[model samples]
Target chain A: MKNNKNTVDPFENEPDFLAQFDKKTPFSVPDHYFESLPEVINDKILKKKSLKFGFDKMSYRILGPSAALIALFFVVFHFYNTPSGNTVQPEEFSDALLNEVSVELDDYMIYDVYAEIIEETESSTEQTSGNETENDEYIDYLLENDIDINTIIEEL
Target chain B: MEHYSDDQLLSMFAARESANYAFNLIVRKYQERLYWHIRRMVIDHDDADDVLQNTFIKAWKGLDNFKNESQLYTWLYRIATNETITFLNKKRKRFLISFHDVEGELTGSLEQDHHFSGKEIELKLQKAILTLPEKQRLVFNMKYYDDMKYEDMSQILNTSVGALKASYHHAVKKIEEYFKNH
Candidate 1:
């Protein structure tokens, strides 16, 4: 309470010139500023409140769905991209397709396909054997005529 | 309009039904005093109006958290004072100017302000007060113009009474020196 005396008489040492000035503020306002301020302030408050509410609502309406859609997209992508035991991989797909074709074929159709494959294999072997015999005959002819084998091979 | 005590107003505001009504009453009661307080800090009436509106808006938002620890008037005053200071600081920051330069700008604007109806001496006194630091100016205004108690100012400013007195003393001496020089 050391300054209590000073606090009680704050203007005790005020200069005469300073004391002569009235306490009235130098500033003024537009007509009836106070009369309408409460309403103006209330309107502003309401506006601010609604603006905040609108932001929250917009988040729910837009951002919420956007987030959900992004999550769904990731989930779907992960579901398709990740290899699961029940899902067919690229390597397994061809085997699966062949198995499916085989299962779909009738007994007669399967027998026909197997027969055709066997016939093609036998023909290919016969052609190879014939080629080997021809090559042996050409070399024998070359030896019998005492022709230069290297020159005969080059001519052949 | 009927006058309601601060307790009555607080209790009315506590209820959802009468909250708006109570707030309107509170605004009506304190708007002029708060306006002048803000107007003095910010020389422009428009700026003061904006600051006052902001102060009330903040009060509306924060009143729920108010624990009635201090007087409602003082609490509202604190909000007004803070809003004014913030407005001034933002002006300074926006222009990238120092505090003293911002005050100089205010002084310049004061001359051009149509809302300023004060005589030449009053304007000179205002300019002299503007030379002090922000806190000293506030103390000087509160003490010299409003004659607010140092105790109430302590709660509003969150500063010690001794410091406030010293600030007021320094502000007075400085203003006197400024007048003597000019």
Candidate 2:
């Protein structure tokens, strides 16, 4: 029996019975099975994707109100517990910290804070005037305060 | 009828627009080989089709995370192998049958299957193969029928080359013995 140099046939020395039998599969597929397989696979994939998307959309529809209710509960709890509040509210604390920061920095920094509060307003120092020193100072202040500028930006 | 290398296909898959197209090309390229591999194990065309569909669906979901640590075909073979085994196991569990019972059922199915057009000796050989322990049967089919090298078989089966060689050797002996008795 001919074999690739890399692959040795273990049945080479076996009886002729094994060697003589053709290794062709006995099974047959439906006509045009191979021709249509890719399209069938694509359809199944599309169907699965659409089903998953539908399920996700349904889940959001079902869970959206529940999430909003949970968030509302936290908000109500925060408002009522303010008198006894020992836990620092991240938003309020960050706001107060930034206000102090604006006072200590240039007047333009205050405009930066205001710009973030309303999306339409442009920051006075949008480019930081290409001022590397002031940029370094602003980043340093953020680091020292354990602040995430993105969190503050998103909240505003 | 263009043939693309695995690297080319994978890179095309990286782009959102061509991902589906690349995947289709991949399916067309490997479907026949994988289909036969699965069909041999399940011994039924419809069951093979279900298992094949499942194998590709799995490959689609997992392809992004495939690290290219192994050849693409080998990775796909591993999935097909695993999916076939899972399909068989599920069948046994669904019917509450033992391993030996399932083998008997598969052999019975083979007898009745209109698609099985094997000659007499080939049918006997297939029945003998079904008697093997599942892993040994896998080793024999890959070695005897597919002419798969031990290294590739080792990767696909996640077995040591020595172990696979030994398994194939034992499988051949058993099939020969089965022919003697029958």
Candidate 3:
């Protein structure tokens, strides 16, 4: 009950109206609720920050190395298998190459290879012999006809 | 820990060096007022505590973006009000309760809660206040308890000043009727 002796209610038709009601709530709290609230709230803020920082550290420490390891594997695999720098090359066909391939070829095929080589040399020789002989014969006939050297130089 | 004006506090807060100090001051200064504001709506100390903490955390996170147009006090009040309303609405939804059921649940809280020491009439007053719509009750609490201005209430609720005045007026009449009969 309120000490309404010194007060008057605005709506006073009824002897006891609500305007005289004291507005103070009678709420209580557990001991030290307010005293500890700041620390409690600050602690929550700190926990959130630390969790975020921990995640960042975990990413840097763990995922960073994991990513590096994957990149290194790719680089090493690429270097070892790439065909440009370290691959072996043959300057010319070798007896070793011929022997290596001969097992896959037939006996006629080997003979055909030698025959083709022989035919190519014979054709080359025939082409050169005709040209040499024709040039020498023409020069000898000119000399036997006894043409003057100065006249030959001037007219021939 | 001497008293500093809101502007001094804000200017100190603007610098990264003194920001934490400024925030602490801000929290200490307004925590009690904001707590009671939320508590009246939610009707539970524990819920008020959670909502209050959330309100401050949000304020701290967004402090840099707080424009100086409105008073910081009203800004915080707005945040606290929204948080309380959201919490109450979610509480109803999470429990799958209707508005009346939620009211019954809150009314029930008055007895079960060890912290609530409201006398019979005060308890009755709370119950009567609860009978009004949530928004009307809110308007009533701010106007009756906090003596908040209609203009400030308008800014907080994003309602027109005329509407808030109307809401407060209806809320008062309902509570008066509740008292007259009971």
> What C-alpha RMSD separates each model from the true structure?
14.8, 18.1, 19.4
lDDT of 2 by residue, A35-127 (tens): 998999999999999999998998799778888999999999998877544444444545676675432334334335533343223244364
- Per residue, candidate 3 scores C-alpha lDDT tens digits across A1-156 of 787865863322222344676777657777988777877777787788789899899989998999999999999999877766432223111242444442233333333333344445556777665654554454455555644433332441
> What residue pairs clash in candidate 3, if any at all?
none
Give Cα-based local distance difference scores for all models. Answer: 0.82, 0.82, 0.76
**Per-residue lDDT tens digits of candidate 2, residues B115-182?**
88889988898899999999998888888778898899999999999898888888888998998999
Docking class of 1: acceptable
Q: List model 1 lDDT by residue over B1-182, tens digit each.
A: 99999999999999999998999999999999999888888899899989999999999999888887999999999999999999999999999999789889999988899999899999999999888899898988988888898999999999998888888888888998998999
Give the TM-score comparing model 2 with the true structure, all chains together.
Answer: 0.70
Give the higher-TM-score candidate: 2 or 3. 2
**Of models 2 and 3, which has the larger lDDT?**
2
Cα TM-score per model: 0.72, 0.70, 0.66
Q: With candidate 1 superimposed using the best TM-score fit, by how many Å does residue A10's alpha carbon deviate from the native?
A: 6.9
